[model samples]
Target chain A: MSTAHTPDRPEDGRDDDPQDRAPEHGHAPGHDQDDRAGYKTDADAGSVDERDEADAPAVDPAAENAEGGEPAARVELPEEQQGEQEIPTFDLTLQIRRYNPEVSDEVHWDEFKLTMYGTDRVLDALHKVKWEIDGSLSFRRSCAHGVCGSDAMRINGQNRLACKVLLKDLDLSKPVTVEPIKGLPCEKDLIVDMEPFFQSYREIMPFLVAGGNEPTMERYQSQEDRARFDDTTKCILCAACTSSCPVFWTDGQYFGPAAIVNAHRFIFDSRDDAGDLRLEILNDKEGVWRCRTTFNCTEACPRGIQVTKAIAEVKNAILSRSM
Target chain B: MSTPLKASISVPRSKDLEVNGVKYNRSSSRRNNFEMYAWLFMRLSGVVLLVLVFVHLWVNLVSPEGGVEAVDFAFVAGKWASPFWQVFDMLLLWLAMLHGTNGLRVIIDDYAERDRTRFWLKVFLFTTSAFVILLGTLVIFTFEPCPAGADPALLASFCAAG
Candidate 1:
């Protein structure tokens, strides 16, 4: 069984063009991964090193297909070249980003192996590796049931919750590797810095503004009014939607999916009195205009939030106000 | 006896204070006040940055030789030789990093669901930014391109002329 779960795209409001907008800041990042955030990453050593010599296979990053020494992405085995390992269980490999500042090239890949059922989730195997094999193998997860919006990482070529995805869901005959969500800072071992992500969120002021009128009782919002902003509110703040965004990956300044989603929550709210002010904040150099509409965030959001639809709502608000 | 003695790197995973085996408890008062202060910061820093940014532009862009010609390796050397430019650059670096990072901190709070992710990611962001700022300040002050080197040709134009 494979652990990868292809995200369902039923046509919400997600942007289809992640590469449409040009980055205004001219922040060119060398795709070398090593040049990221000034971390010294070993281009040679496989990122994942299992401290525990267990039944796990050495599946950090899969073998490169010999393209200029860059690690080759592992292709799904065609059922014939798989299950060759005679170990009692499976060998799903993982490749994670690692960084040490005092060194050069702050990005590199590490690998690890874990025995599993075809139906096992990527998160289960990670727990096993962290507990039994490598104590230092780090990734973020909480509410293992997927409610809390943690454990957002890139499995194979997509962003997902290690807890929510089942190995059986993917083509498990081949090794499955994991990395931190793209478009953000990789702190170390499958983690990325989120302060920039949060800055965008807070910049939108994801809150209620009771217009200048001060009523006696609490602000009353009709259920339909509330429901208008409800789906947007489903954001657990997991950056899966944002990091899956390639535009965010290049420029750390973009407001991103979740930020616009939060803005939608207020912009469409009947109670918010300061739509113009909020829009002004987003109009700055690194505002909503930077979004190139990559559906990656919608595809990666585990909560099934309609990321692009929400972004559209924000744009509509801005346009309506400017007119 | 078999354990390797590598320098233990302590990455405070969530930066959530842990004292005596318990997570640091926060008072509601502080959280409410934190928002107030954050609001204050955005306004104040926005104002200060306006001044700093324009002043910075004036110094570099509105100067002689259309500004570019006046700036050279020796120009940089001369600027840092005084305490004024050092302080100015230092302020710009710190304020920019802090303003940008604080902006990020707010965004993160608006997203990142799990406490662990928030804690660890912030720890990473804070540490990295702090480290860069610290290193940048050091370089700005102590940079010595010609440290009594044998290559006199590369010496400052002023030194050669004198």
Candidate 2:
């Protein structure tokens, strides 16, 4: 549960230490001020000159020495650039459900207040808490961008990737409730045991199985054929869709939506020859028949796959093959 | 003052997690088309039941001169006197009961966590369904509107006309 303390810094050459940085001037550096000054005439001459004086840069020798023998780079930046434009920040409150059986069998909600930027996501808010407030506030996240699919959780009662949901998009007027996805065993705060979900995925035989000899060159498929299963191919193995299912929450034996979606990916592929076997696997007592077509999986999918439709298609495929 | 933390703690691994009090194992494939037929039967019977149920309701409740009040023992006896009405009622009784039994069986399988519980529930469901279906079929076909030497006051007026 321990996270490495890696402070995120802006990619621009800006110093983290406030004292080493220059004072703030409201406007952008030289480029933006020049564009604004172009609209002014002789009547605004005095105000323009006053603004120019405020833009003048001052270098500190002590700051230069502290920067490890490098010249004072602060003097080179237009005074406006020295201090970046104030990213409009607002106070955000996150109420996270914390569970650790080792400490206590009872799960409790922990609240955190953070100053987050308008562009910051729920993942950023969590990072601020984990990095600055409490290092023990654990959650799974890799590739802070949305691709890794590591940080799917229930944000304010809906399943979503923490990295993909912007703070501004949420109703920040209320405290955002962050809980582990439902129907999975919670290992710790915001982390669910994904093994059962993955087991269902593995049961479906996710990879393509073609019976013929391997193609000498790449197995070419028409674009039309590729497009058939293309929507399901975007699955990153995030359990968001499966955990949201009401049936999955109750009937654990059922192969969940993600597994069926993964099965759909390979089942419809024109090149794969094992469609019959996969259909047989899904035609069990706990298979597509168990799906109530609730559309919860469709709504919860971060990859935007039409999960209910895919399950229906599989049902049709099974019926056609058997009956 | 803060309490001292435990020196060591045991956390269960993800693989050790049990769902619904049992470790997740896919149910053994029955390798039969029973569930497929059952599923299809639900859909097909559902459509047929919609028509059968509405028509039955209209004939009994809406079409009669006094509506529901006009429906009495004599009315039912008169309707069952015809073979067409007999067959229609039989179809309604069988399809509705089977449809309901199958639906309840699926629900029991879904909600019942224990195998014994599911088994007993389905057993109860099938037994009751069979009883009703058998009794209903017998009543529909073998029912006689009039019997010999029945009390004149107890008999419906239509029986006296015959």
lDDT string for model 2 (A32-144, tens) is: 11221233333454564355345334322222222122111211112222344654568878999999878998999999988886446788899889999989888999866
Candidate 1 lDDT by residue in tens digits, A114-233: 667433468878888889887877777766655566788888888887776656455556667788887665667777767667766765767666545567777788999988878787
C-alpha TM-score for every candidate: 0.48, 0.77
Q: If chain B of candidate 1 is superposed on the true chain B, what is its TM-score?
A: 0.67
Model 1 chain A: worst 10 consecutive residues (lDDT sum):
A20-29
Q: What ranges in model 2 sit over 4 Å off? A: A1-85, B1-22, B148-158
- Among all candidates shown, the one with the greatest TM-score: 2
The candidates' DockQ values read 0.01, 0.15
What is each predicted model's overall lDDT from 0 to 1?
A: 0.60, 0.73
Stretches off by above 4 angstroms in model 1 are A1-91, A100-106, A212-217, B1-162
TM-scores of chain B, in order:
0.67, 0.82
> What TM-score does model 2 achieve against the real structure?
0.77
Worst 10 residues of 1 chain B by lDDT: B23-32
